[model samples]
Target: MSRKLLPDFLARAHDDRDPSPWLALWLDQSTPLPDPVKTAWLADSSSASRQYLLPFLRPLARTVIVLLQVVKVFFPRNWSHSGALHALLVWGLKRFVSPQANWLILRHFHLGSQVLAFIARNSPAPVPTSPLEPTDIDALRDDLFLKHDLNLFNFVIRLNQALRDQGLELHKPAHLDLTMLRDPDLKLEDMPHGRLNFLDLQSAIELFTPLYQLLLTDNDFWRAANSLQLDETIGIYCATLLAAPEHLVLVNNKHPLVPLSTLRAGHRLVIHGLSTEMLHALLMRFKQAQAEGGVVHTTSGDASAQ
Candidate 1:
């Protein structure tokens, strides 16, 4: 498949009202695509976008759709790629710098309608019949619920909207279990080797509690930058995990290593995508912490003593 023919194939799929032929040609890129409509086969990948060159969606899309159909019976939310990543990608690709490529990418992913809806106009907020009156039932419920747990400014704003959407005259929805942690085990927010700042201590405890394991993505040891917020910093490291190895590693962004031992299944260890030497240094620190009874957890699993 050549870039020259991908658009043509898509147009052909639309005309034929079936993706099987398009899919066949799609799969054949490195091989040969099968065309049920015209009873033809094509050889070669249609494009060079690395992702397009791969046969990911070509073979898996139909299977994924079938799985989604079954999962839909049990899950209230949509988990289809179209609903999750596809919808998100639709928004992102629509904003892609190249106008033609944006449209093409959406079409390539079969996200045309969502792209159109996004481009059309702003979504409207529902009009409220009344404000938060002091005597109102909703006002009373608001006092009972959503009056705590969240920062006041944002909390009030979200609570008001949720109350309105429920169509209930009462003020609040019941408190949800979302605020609680599912696991009871002790967790470590890894302090980078350098000296710790007081706020970093606070922020680490805040951010790392929920996520027990981290796979470091780069050569750079994560120093808690006084200037940088922990959330943004942690997010950057986590995003790099896709390129990391199957086993948890502490690596500089460019290289990877296999830790000498396996981690216990439940230990909330942060993984760094790091090299062997760096991994050893970090693991040793864990050992010191363990010997000193600094960390509350232990593993008979394979992770090495640093």
Candidate 2:
């Protein structure tokens, strides 16, 4: 899509009652986007100020990252759970950010919490360190986002091992033996390298933490930030479904449907427009595909089946 026509395409995807057509376009990544078009995509997710300031924020963000590491050494278990810290952060976020920005922030935490809980229940892995089931959107952000990013990181590692042990892939389906997960034999390890690392959860959380208040009404900033959170949540869940046993399959392969690689490249297909609802609709498409025997051909070209 050309830069000149990109906004119109975004409008159609974002505004139309049925966004399936535009969704198809956004999900296709075969046609490499130009740098300008990629910038437009970023702009659609964030403010120009954010885009410009993000590069500059690197140093300060790094300092905050180191500081957080030091604080964790001293307080390990309690550093992130301070009521005052949570309250102050939430007040600042809610008071300074746009409602759209706030929604993106809250929704991803909520979904992340839900998805983690699902994985914990279904996988034969070490249980997540933090409570996976959050009570509300507020708890999702203040508790899950602030208090448990590392724990989520830990859980993904163990879950991957458990899947591997069972002769299964995270993105492919096999009937998981629930009894085996009852006393999972997996061990937590340092972060895995390459694609299995998935999203850089801690760095991503840190990247936006300092900017929440500064971004003010920049919903796009929150959208761009939360989109990373969304990527982790969606990636794991979609992978879980794709690898689901025959009876549980929701998708055959990721391909032209989800744009997993494109999301990691910083495009906003998953977080764009009516995010959560759009995800549900996408899942429904997968469900329909399952009913039709799990074969989906797309213009994006990759047609290898799971």
Best by lDDT: 2
Candidate 2 structure, TM-score to reference: 0.42
TM-scores of the models, in the given order? 0.17, 0.42
lDDT values, one for every candidate: 0.24, 0.39
lDDT of 1 by residue, 95-175 (tens): 321222222111211111111121111112222111121221122223211111112223224434654686533211222
> Residue-wise lDDT of candidate 2 within 111-213, one digit each (tens)?
4444455456545443453444433335544444434444554655667777677776444335322221111111112112232222222223344454432
lDDT of 1 at 83: 26
Roughly what TM-score does model 1 have, to 2 decimal places? 0.17
Measured on C-alpha atoms, candidate 2 has an lDDT of: 0.39
